[model samples]
Target: MSQCLNPDCLHSNPKGCQFCQKCGSKLRLVERYYAKSILGQGGFGRTFLAVDDFKPSKPPCVIKQFLPQAQGTATLEKAAQLFDQEAQRLELLGKHSQIPELLAYFTADNRQYLIQEFIEGDTLQ
Candidate 1:
């Protein structure tokens, strides 16, 4: 199944679907990652379990969408700044074997996304 990233219509669609059945949102992000399920969500944004179709192995990855829950322009701007900082930090920290490697980060459909290597097992959360 492919999961829709739209916050208003996060519907699940069958595999191979190019777009969400419910909301018509594209199933793929950056023309590669297909979000299968949500891993977690918080005030900052949401994390999704995804697969990178661009890779030969179609390896699993984590996709972080910057969807701040805070209100007001200042709060939203601050949240966006923090999100960018988090991505920058991940890019640097990923050099270590202990930290999950950053795969890709970009903005699409007006939403910012950060893709990273997936680590199996329970999350620290």
Candidate 2:
């Protein structure tokens, strides 16, 4: 299955679809990551289950798309800045076994994304 990365659609698409049926958005991201399903979402961001093409096993990953709830240019800029900082922090914290390793952080299609190793387990929530 192919997952629509568009925040508006955020649904699974047919395997061969080049574009999203719901929103007509592209079905891939960063040329390497192919999202398969949305894991979850909040007011601040959304997370996706994706596969890395570079890996021989096509390892699953978590693609965290930054979507700030606040409106306005200044707010968006601040959100981007904070997201960068968080990426840096994750890089450091990833050394510990408990934290997921940060794989990549980049911007495309006027949006920000943080790709990390998908840790399969339960959460307190």
- Cα lDDT computed for each candidate against the true fold: 0.92, 0.88
**What would the per-residue lDDT of candidate 2 be over residues 8-102, giving only the tens digit for each residue?**
77778888777888888877787788899889988769999998978899999999999999899999888889999999999999898889999
Worst 10 residues of 2 by lDDT: 116-125
User: Alpha carbon lDDT of residue 28, candidate 2?
Assistant: 74
Q: On residues 1-125, what C-alpha lDDT tens digit does candidate 1 reach at each position?
A: 99999999989899899999999988989789999999999887899999999989999999999998889999988888988999899999999877899999899999999999998877634
- The list of candidate 2 runs beyond 4 A from truth reads 122-125
lDDT, candidate 1, at 93: 100
Question: Largest lDDT belongs to which candidate?
Answer: 1
Each candidate's TM vs. the true structure? Answer: 0.94, 0.89
Model 2 TM-score (2 dp):
0.89
Q: What's model 2's lDDT at 113?
A: 93
* Candidate 1 clash figure, as a count: 0
